[model samples]
Target: MMLREVNTQGETKSGEMIAEMIIECIKEAGHENVVQVVTDNASNCVKACALISAKFPTILWTPCVVHTLNLALKNICAPVHNPRSNEDVYDACYWIKSISEDVTWIKNFIMNHGMRLVMFT
Candidate 1:
């Protein structure tokens, strides 16, 4: 269950607030029923996990695997390196770029054609 809906009008979310919110949710859901907490790999979220671990040592806090996988893919697709000379540096994986472009083109093609989109769906 969602504990709170963060809004743009309020103060920026802090580690403490996030921890408290998670604790509240765990309590509401029955602490015994919750084996672990999965959260995104944001710095605030990681800090919140630390806070949670400090308060409840038995409960495990883990980063979302999907987020971790996406980060890995992003790093592999777009690598950063220092260029030795004054030239453009494109270190992205060619195969990954080609696949991504093909997927994008397919999506655009399907979206542009009503019948093709219906058939694809």
Candidate 2:
């Protein structure tokens, strides 16, 4: 269950804020019940998890596999040229871009629809 969704549109989500949010949730849920904390592998999230691990040495921090796979797929299907290089390294696999777009659409559909999201989770 999600504890809270902070409005981060214009706000800076620093490591301290993220760590505090997780710690707050842990406190509410009872510290002893928390064995692991999982978050997407973003730089700030990684830092936050590190801080959390330091605060609660027993609780393990894990990166979300889905996020990792999504990032991998993004790099493969939407290969951008390097700043110095003018060629697409994966131009031969451009066909995969359409499939990736469709997958993104499906994910957005499920996530946007309350009932579908509930069922998916």
On lDDT, the leading prediction is 2
Please list the residue runs of candidate 2 whose C-alpha ends up more than 4 Å from where it truly belongs after superposition: 82-99, 114-121
The TM-scores of all predictions, comma-separated, are: 0.63, 0.75
The ten-residue window of minimal lDDT in model 1 covers 81-90
* Model 1 per-residue lDDT tens digits across residues 5-104: 5553677778888898889988888888778989999999999999998988888998999789767555555555332322232443546766666866
For 1-121, candidate 2 gives per-residue lDDT tens digits of: 6666676788788999999989999899887999999999999999999999998999999999999988867777645533343245567667777888998999899778879646534
Estimate the Cα RMSD of every predicted model relative to the unseen true structure: 7.0, 3.5
Clash totals, every prediction: 0, 0
Worst 10 residues of 2 by lDDT: 78-87
Clash pairs (backbone) in predicted model 1: none
Q: What is the Å distance of residue 44 in model 2 from its true position?
A: 1.1
